[model samples]
Target chain A: MQAQDLTTEVAGLSVHLLRGGEGDPAVVLHHSTGPIGWVPFHDELAQRFAVHAVDLPGYGRSDRPSWARHPRDLAILLNRALEQLEMDGVTLIGAGFGGFVAAEMAAMTDARLRSLVLVGAAGIQPAEGEILDQMVLKEEFYVQKSFRDEESFRAFYGEDETGELADLWDFSREMTARVTWRPYMFDRRLPHILATVRTPTLLVWGEEDRVIPRSCAELYARALPNAQLEIVPEAGHVAEYEQPETVARLIAEHVGSLA
Target chain B: MFISYFTERPYQDEQGEYINTLDLAKSNADYNPVLGGDLYHRYLDEKVYAEEMGFDGLVLNEHHSMPACMGGVINVEASILARITKRARIVLAGNVLPIWDDPLWLAETLAMIDVISRGRLVCGWVRGTGRESVTHNTPSPYNWERYQEAHDLIMKAWTEPGPFRWEGEHFDYRYVNPWPRPLQQPPPIWIPGSLSKATVKWAAERQFPYLMLATEHEPTKRSFEYYDACAREAGHETGSQHRGYLFKVHVDETEELAEQTARKFLQGPSNPFLEGNQGQVRGFMQNLPGMNSRTEVLPTIETWAPAVARGAQRQHKKILEKKKMAKGKDRDYSGSYEEQIAKYTIIAGTPDQVVEKIRNVLEYLRPGIIAIWDGDGAMSHEDTMRALRLLGEEVIPRVREIGKELDLHSPFEVSPVTNKPVAEAVGVG
Candidate 1:
């Protein structure tokens, strides 16, 4: 499926809503580099759930509003986008930095978030091995040090065999630059807020991931009383891109089980 | 003016044979699940230690997907260097600015570094080596033109009255002002090149320094002559005052020991194992007018190897397999200390001999500055420290003495810290 299949709008200052996918309401938030065209995984998820992918303010097609100073401001702007979409009683799936936003939404909002699924999510304060510090400060650091193999690089990037790998590579780099480009992940208080998220969560991680290490998954799984951990082998940081079928099946099953 | 070792210490594998650059880069992949943070921290630590050792400046450069040269992002190194050495000048000896989406960010980042370090920043601009720009998705047809435009934009952003608009062929901006102004009045600018007439002329027009890599002495001398005449015609003073050269140096207790050390070092496997990658270098240089001509520019491995092999066959009345082996081995010396120094493009000797040889070069070239590339081939930390000590203590002082004889002034003079001059003579501004 092409990204053109999805329609988008500015839900608030620096925030955009990509509307498509029909079923039980599922809010899909993207990582940094902004709102992208719909992926096959998003399409698959759309088959069973109404999907709403958000472009955080200052990224993607969203406006770079001056009011959005930090990640909390981003969290507030994300909440407003949900309000604009009139989205309630939804399952939230966040990837990379988007996962941080999803976790924040689950923790703070009184909205009806049925469940949370964080795929290669980044928000928890990592005490030991924090890739965020390096990723945010120096992009080349991540590019040079992250991927283990050519396959891993290609997979995490989510480029298909269509020779559009060049464009996708540029997009992946730009996305990384946009999200972690400033003050990095978010305020240190974010991990403390993770404890308040009562939503039943699924922590999905790529075994070969470098952006957010697999060890971080164990931390999140331990912190959230109701969270489950699934390790996808042979995948890097972007597990959804690498193992979309498995990720989709897992998500579908998880959401169904919640019912 | 500065010498920093490009350490390849990590290439040492289990068998003690130095691994190729490609394998070294790939080796990190094995630890991808665990050691990313440690590797990054170690990289930073190396740069920080370089500052503590008291080099005039720290150097970081960019190369992509090449194992021999792992510094893929020069800016990242610059950032780390800036944080550690708050007072020392951080020189990114020409980032391939043309490949970037916005060179203004480079200017802005440099400005921020200047502010953070209170003005100890020097910016170098370059068009980059051939074929490397392809990975950045930069248009090869317009590389030189884009480089020129990017250089101008960054300069204007740094020097011009800001909040002004900038509309250019490549960039359009309504607000041209960038925060954190550079402290050095204007941070010093240096341009590094080998055989580009356009680059030479540009540096000449601006009266900025030109850093020449070690090429054949005749062509290098001729290039400097052309640079001198051009600078003079432009009504600018010309001499070694702004001319520097980058060369590899290996010092040992004796000449024999130095050669032995170099041979052992050269025997290590080459980094960057990709096939057809060497064509990138050839394709890049072939585009430049003077460099495009095989005879005009100095011969590299591509031109030199087959010729030498053919010559050896003619001499022996048969194709000697050993000659081919030698040629292959020579090609692998792209990152070797011995090959670089033995060619006299770089200098290898005991500290005393190195000092004497450098003095000879100064007499012949009269360059204003001398930049030493001690960082190559994963040089050991201890060896690098020793080289720095010898350079700072022995070589630099001797060079200064020679400068006195030539009536050349030192480029660096102490910044007047106290207001004694204006305070006593006139009121402070």
Candidate 2:
């Protein structure tokens, strides 16, 4: 399944959207390192639900409005875009830093969101260890540490030279700094507001994840009143990007249960 | 001609080993408190002396996580200089605008300096270099925007009457009423740039004296001309007062002694990290992706592309050309220091010889203001004191004569010191 590029305006800023799949809308919110093209995980989920992979403001080709300076601002902007797109009953899946943004939207909005799936997410600060600040880490090292498959690491490094990929790397880092630099990644008030998110949540984790500790996943599971935890074996922080088939299988089952 | 004193306050100790410039976290092992303490105090003493030497101003700049200078907060030093120096403009060339989360503090602090200095504060705003971006982790693209907003906010806080709310793009303040406001009304604002057309044109448009830092004769002329063209386009003709040049110059009683002292600049010791900065973790961290737009980065790319690419052609000369010293090809100044002096990068000789070199530089660049650096790297404090002695007793006064003959109007001469009121309560002239 091939995904097509799209652009939409929200709050006077241009949003870069890549749409594919069919059926109900499944929004894929990417990590801090902004998503450019569709990944394998999107394709796997596309079989059941239409996927709308968005480049968050200041990430990928999207124009970063000056006012989107906080995580809440990003949440508001994303929700505005979805509302303009007339998307309803959408299954929201967010990965890494995107998870932080996703959790905020889930807390505030009720009518549009059907379910929430957080993968190796970052929102709750864990007791044992905090999420690793990825700004200082080299690109190749980040990809290597985030993946369980050695081939996946090698393939990512092999093709990173193209100019577009380099720009995405920069956008992701800058936007991350804009929203997450001060409080680190997690919103301090999120845990108290978790109960507001009426939709069921599924927390997916990479068993070998090191970027954000597995402790965060357990924290999310404990905090959310209606949530389940599923840790995939031999995967890291980017569990979906590393093991898309396994993550998709869990997400698909979760969607079925929700329906 | 406006003569000023500048230094990076090097942490001169041989015990510490070289570390990577980019990875500042891991690279901080080189610092020794004993050395740092001695250096910071001495820099203050040097500023006091610069004021005593009848120099028009003292230039204090900001840099982070570098062993070469301890000026992480320039205003702290400026505040001290306010109380200490009786005369001489406290020229901050200048505070890095993007790093400060609260520009209100900056407005208040500079106001305090202006009050204490009895209305002698020349504020210079700079975007800072790439090293600063990574060290502070400020977004590169916003360097321009933040600098603009921060500048506007400070100006508003100073000029706009009590308690006006500011809702700028980068900064939002409910109330901006700085107590103990600046004495100089709108203190003389200066900006330093290389070949950056944006900065040069901005300075021209705003009527700020654009100070060119150690750029070669040709590039400096082109930049000056560009500023002139900008001023003309904006409906005013620019003069010598619009241009200022800074040089790393050394003067002693003997030629050999002068060359030895002046040659340290080629070392590019400015990086703080003894190792090269390119492609390193800090380099990537500072440069990130959008920190600088292509247009913003073009001038730098044009300047350093060939030298960085033709690395093989770089000879054993430790000291590279100033043009090659921007960001990419930070060539370590090595080899025949005498040869580099001949390249005219560093003006070194007897007092008479140094005067001739200064005249040549002034003629080629024709700047109304000139800042000189007499210390860095291995150059000792005594060497700096001696260099200053020659500059004050001999170089500065002579330059004044030459400047008069050349009609190089200082910023003071072009726009005479007319008191700009901070508030209506302060009584406007």
Best-fitting candidate, measured by lDDT? 2
DockQ of 1: 0.01
lDDT of the candidates, in the order given: 0.59, 0.74
| Number of the top TM-score candidate | 2
Lowest lDDT sum, 10 consecutive residues, model 2 chain A, at A156-165
> lDDT by residue for model 1 over B282-309, one digit each (tens)?
2212231111122322222232322221
The regions of model 2 sitting more than 4 angstroms off are A5-16, A22-24, A84-86, A138-145, A148-151, B18-23, B26-34, B129-141, B172-175, B195-197, B266-281, B288-290, B297-301, B305-343, B416-429
* Share of true Cα-Cα contacts across chains kept by each model: 0.00, 0.26
Model 2 per-residue lDDT tens digits across residues A168-236? 665577777777766678877888898767889999999988888888888888778889999998688
Q: In angstroms, how far off is B8's CA in candidate 2?
A: 1.0
Interface RMSD of 1: 13.1
